[model samples]
Target: MSQLRSMYPPIEPYSAGTLDVGEGYRVYYERVGTPGAKPAVFLHGGPGGGLSPEHRRLFDPNRYDVMLFDQRGCGQSTPYAGLEANTTWHLVSDIERLRALAGVDKWLVFGGSWGSTLALAYAETHPDRVSELVLRGVYTVTKAELQWYYQFGVSEIFPEKWEKFQAPIPLSERGDMIAAYRSRLTGDDRATQLEAAKAWAIWEGETITLLPNPAFSTSFGDDQFALAFARLENHYFVHDCWLEDGQLLRNAHRLRGIPGAIVHGRYDMPCPARYAYALHRAWPDAAFHLVEGAGHAWSEPGILDQLVRATDRFATAP
Candidate 1:
C-alpha cells in the first residue's frame, strides 16, 4: 500500500550516443542523472516499444546513473521498424555492448512486460553483470501465455475490444490471430501495414488498462512507431520470443542469488498476475507484491507506486 514517490524533476541526459552493435543494428542510448552514480538501465517493454523521457524519472537524479535505450529498430535506432537481426538474444547482447560502452561493471536493471522477459534473459545470461532487478507486469512469453491473451482468455473479459482486434482478420485466420496479423504487419504494402498496425496497436491499448485510459492515445499515431510495435511484437510472439518452451522459467535457477522485486497488477489482461506469481515462486528469494485494482499499464497509479518504491529500495541497498 505504499504510494509512489514523486518522480525526479525532468532532467536532460548528460550524454547520448548510438552504439553500433553490428548486424546492421545501432542502438540509441542516453545516460541521465548523476554522471558518476549507481548505473541503472531501463529496459523498455514491447519488443519494439522504444524509450521515452518519462522512463528516466523513476530514479533519483542525485543518486542513480540512469540509462535508457531504444532496442534494435526502435525509437531513435537507425532502421525504423526494421526487423532484420532482431531477436531476444540480439537484445541481450546489445545490452552488454551498451554496458561496456558506458564503462559500468554492474548496474541495476528495470523492466516490465516484455522488458521483464528481456531482463530475466539478460540477467540469467550474465548474472555477474546485474547488481539487482526490479520487474513489473512480468511476462515469460510462453506459448500458452500468448494464447491466453490473444487466442481466447482476455477476449472473454474484453470481448468488444477483442472483436476489433479480430475484425482485421478473416474468419479462416481467426484461429490464429498472431499469424494473421503478422502477414499484414510485415507485408510489402505500406498502406496495408499501417492499417494493420493501428488495429493491432489499438487492441492492445484498449485492453492494457483495467479501467479505460482516457489519456491513453493510440501509439500508432506515428506510423513508424505503430508499424514497429505491431510488427516486432508479432514477430517475437510468432517465434515464441525465440525461446524454448518454458525456457525463462526453466532457467530461473540462474536468478537464485540476484536481489529482485516483482510488482504485478491483480488484473493485468496482457500478462495475467499468475505469470508473476509463478516467476516469484521460481525465484523464491525475490520479493513480490500484487497490486489490486490495477491492470497491465505501468501508468496505473497503484502499479506505478509499487514499481517506483521497488526501484527506490534497490537504489539504497548495499
Candidate 2:
C-alpha cells in the first residue's frame, strides 16, 4: 500500500459562523488558514457525514484558505437529523450560499464519497465557479450505485456485515433497505430510531475500509451523530439523491474545461471502482487513479496519498 502524505498540522478555524439558509435551516461554516490565501471548499461525505477537525488538515493552511461546514442537519448544524426540505439540491445551493458569504468568487472543490457526488452536482450547476476538483472514493449516487451499496452489490462481499445491516429489517423489505431503514430512522419511538441509527451507521463504518478500523467503529455510538448520519443517508438514498437518473455523468459536459483529479480505492465495496471509471470515461480530462490495497475510507493510506498529491498539484497550478 502506498503511504499517505503527511497531513497538515491540526488547526482550528480562524473564523466561524452559521448562515440561516431559510426554512429553519442554518449551516455551520468555518474558515481556516491565511484568510487571503487561494480559497478552497471541502465537501464532506455521507450527505450527513459533515466535517471534522482532521478534514481541515487535507489542505495546506498557508497555500489555501479552507472552508468546511456541517451541511443542513449534520455536524454542528441545527435541527440535528432533520430531513424536511433537505435534498441534494438544497446542499448544492447551500454551497453557493456559503461561498457568497465567505466572499470567494471561485474555489477548488475537494470532496470524497457523497462529497464527490455533491461536488459534481455543484460543479455541473455552476461550473464557472469551480477552479478545480479533487475527489476521492468517487460516488455519484446513481440508481445502480445505490442498489449496489444498499440493495445488492455490497452484500456479495460483506455477507456477514450485510446480515447485521439487514437484521433490523424484515426479509420482504430487504429489497428496499433504504426504505426500511428510513421507516425506523424516522419512526416516532426514540429507542427504535436510535437502535436502527446505530445499525445503519455501524454497518457502513465497518465496511468502509479494506480492514477493520476500531477508531471508526466508535463513532457509531454517538446518538446525535448516528441519528443524523443514518437518517440523512437513508433519506437521500430513498430519494435516489434527488437527481435525474445518471445525472452526474449525463451532465459531465459541463465540466469540459474544469481540471479534476479522481482518486478511488480499487477495493471500495460500498462504492465500487466502476463508478469512478464511468465518470472518467465521461470526463476524460479529469485524471483518474485507482489506488491498490484500499477501500472507501479516505484514511486508507494509498487513497490518502493520491488525494494529497492531487491537492498539492492543484496548489501549484496556474
Q: List the residue pairs that clash in candidate 2.
A: none
Candidate 1, pairs of clashing residues: none
Number of clashes in every candidate structure?
0, 0
TM-score of each: 0.97, 0.97
Off by over 4 Å in 2: 1-4
lDDT of 2 by residue, 151-259 (tens): 8988888899889999989888887888889889998999999989998999899999999998888986578789899999999888989888988988998999899
Summarize candidate 1's per-residue lDDT along 1-318 as a digit string, tens digits.
344565667889999999899988888999998887888999999988888888888888888998899999889997888888999999999999989987999999999899999999999999999999999999999888999988989999988878888887889999999999999988888888888898887778788888987545445445777788888899999999999988998899999898999999999999978889999999986899998999998878888887778787888775
| Lowest lDDT 10-residue stretch of candidate 2 | 1-10
What Cα-based lDDT does every candidate model obtain?
0.88, 0.89
